[model samples]
Target: MKNDVKIRNEMLSWYDAHARVLPWRSKPSERPDPYYVWLSEVMLQQTTVQAVVPYFEKFISIWPTVHDLASATQDDVLREWAGLGYYSRARNLYKCAQAIVSEHDGIFPNSVKTLKSLSGIGDYTSAAIASIAFDIPSVVIDGNVERVISRLHRIDAPLPDSKTIIREYAQNLFIGDNTDRPSCFAQSLMDLGATICTPKSPKCEICPISKYCVAFEHCDAQVYPKKRKKSKIPEKYGVAYIYVHDGKVGIEKRPEKGMLAGMVGFPTSEWNEDSVDNIDDDMSAYKIRHVFTHFALTLYPQIINQKTYNMIEFKEVDKIGLPTLFKKVWNMIESDL
Candidate 1:
């Protein structure tokens, strides 16, 4: 057997004995449920596993199946998915559930090509769902897998640019394993990168496949997945106008396009790169800052003795689907009330 085959076998064997027991993952003896797989994969995008656990449990508990989720209102879904940033995923999750129920008769498509056609199921997500849930042969490469591949081959190219090379390298691992469990093989790579071959200070000593890792041999595993220098993130300024009446706060749905699109938030001024911060001494309650993927936002909360027709009870704020940025602003202003 080739070195790649040896590495693959060792990785899967390590995974079988030490796989992280996540709620959505099926036991080794059982096949995974496609709905749970798709839902967990969607929730895990750009979000940490710790943050996604409660949200995943809540969503699965409330909407047990695709059909149940399809019947749920978009507002309810968003509410349940609050705090797990990337609100568009919640929107797409609803649409995908509906599509699965109506288009595919409530059954998740087992093929990568078919899964890709679903809303929000991109190339990576589709591969993940096809391989993990259905036991199909598919190349699943996320950030973790990319790091592992880059280190294993000592690929020096910077990320985003090196992604194609890393993916091709990862693809070879799952190519001829007809008898092996492809799902375990794919997930093991992910888990290995997550736990052992981490981006920073990787626990190389305990890494199962460290013998085959080119970067590890050279003592440069941390530097394998080189990344381009990020451009300075621009800062945007805005004011969140908090209105309270009868113990309810004013919240409105943002426009269905642009930042925080279609999510619930307090009324605010435009978040512009050059926007001036017009904070009055009496009106300004607090200033809060949040960093997004592309930009940093500074929001000045101005409390008013006025009320808008749109009001949600302050005690019920947890039930409303407020994005992380808005939630931070709310926490700052809520203390004043």
Candidate 2:
């Protein structure tokens, strides 16, 4: 335990001197805003810091406050979140904002238990907000933290499922006093994992905790956080009906639930292994393939000549906001024309 204390103190000191200048970090004499912390955490889920930076900036500029976000229209929110992918996160973000307004009087809840009760606020998010916003003593175990902990202790359990044990270890190591600087500690661990103790080719030479990290001492950091073998994603086929009329394209809003929910996309149907039947109208077939995080999709772009379909709306293609997957479909249609 003495060694653990030494490790923690050394890591914190390194962090104080080396922490990156992120937008959410508070200035001296300024208390961290729960709203900003919550918003950033939600946007950062499954997204890279580089990718999320612009989105976070845009969101803060547009909404500015929890009340502003809660009162904004769903369409406006979805449109702002258009290219971010993971539409569910956007939807739940709105829901969470409204929840805070209605239940917590537009103020972000300070306690982990209360924050978790908000929509889309999971354990990780709650801990992040509690520590960063209210300066509460809470352990934040994000993916970066998990990797750092797993390597530091040389735990070999596969990722995701191994998260619980990793969290337990982190909780044990936490030095949470009443006035503990949980925010700095949490972000420091994350920064260490992200920059130094990375998943591949860790930079242990400059790591402050290298002396105590078991994986570094053993030179097996890459092998500490074992990952389960990923199963091959089955190929699924779908048809995107591209109806062009008067130099405009026809798009439909996806259902309010499920994949790509509430986003404007090309008209499509359930995917199957076999080709679509009953070819209607004079349309040329183009093929495009795309890969989601979990599935592979093969889209058969059937271009229906504008003469046959009267139920179409046309606007300059460049003016439309389409999902990335559907953007590929549009590019295929334009290139083939």
In order, candidate lDDTs are: 0.86, 0.80
Q: Give candidate 2 misplaced runs (Cα > 4 Å).
A: 175-179, 275-285, 307-320, 335-337
Task: Tell me the tens digit of each residue's lDDT in model 2 across 167-223.
Answer: 777776664322246777778887898788888888989999899889888988888
| Runs in model 1 lying further than 4 Å from the true structure | 177-179, 275-277, 280-283
Writing each residue's lDDT as its tens digit, candidate 1 over 132-160 gives: 99888888888988888898899988988
Clashing pairs in 2: none
Model 1 residue 206 CA deviation in Å = 1.1
The TM-score obtained by model 1 is 0.95
Model 2 is weakest, by summed lDDT over 10 consecutive residues, at 307-316
Report residue 57 deviation for candidate 2 (angstroms): 1.2
